[model samples]
Target: MKILVAAAAGMSTSLMVRKMEEYMTANGLVGVVDAVSVAEAKERIRECDVVLVAPQVRFELAGLHQIAEPLRIPVGGIPAPIFAGMKGEEAVRLAQDLIAQAAEPTS
Candidate 1:
């Protein structure tokens, strides 16, 4: 799975990506996680299975959904508490859940 994390300046999300990368390594998950600015995120949404926006920029979720929905990719805002705490595993679990949900047929 590929996950794209977006933030205001695409700066803060790097830490989250690092933590997620560590989690992926530890769990042997072949997933890739990366961070980008909202503009850049728009360009790469198709290359990702899930899109997570930083809490500080959660307001963008609606716009993000507009992009992800048509692509059938899941998009959501990371929970502030967990994101602020830098809970990598928890974030990974959230991404997994999004990917799982996206895989399900929604009639």
Candidate 2:
């Protein structure tokens, strides 16, 4: 699975991506986690399994959804607490859940 994280410009976003990558490696999951500015997310969305928007860029969620929904790609916003705390595990779980839900068949 490939996870794309969209955030405002900062080094913290890079750190968060590293944490998520470490979590995936420790858990034996084969995947790639990448961070990009919100402006770049729309272009890169097709390359990832799921898109996670940082708390600071939550306002762009709807715009992202416009692009992702049509492609059956899941897009969600990381909670303020989780993003602020840099809880990579929780963020990864959130991405996993979104992917799972997207794979489900409608009843």
Error of 2 at 9 (Å): 2.6
TM-score (C-alpha) between model 2 and the true structure: 0.96
The C-alpha TM-scores of every prediction are 0.94, 0.96
For candidate 1, the TM-score is 0.94
lDDT per residue as tens, model 2, 1-107: 99999988689899889889988999998999989988898999999999999988899999999999989999999998988898989999999999999999989
Query: Per-residue CA lDDT of candidate 1, range 1-107, in tens?
Result: 89998887644578889999999999999989888888888889999999999998888889999999988999988999889888989999999999899899989
RMSD of each: 1.1, 0.8
User: Candidate 2 clashing pairs?
Assistant: none
- Give the runs in model 1 whose Cα sits over 4 Å from its true position: none
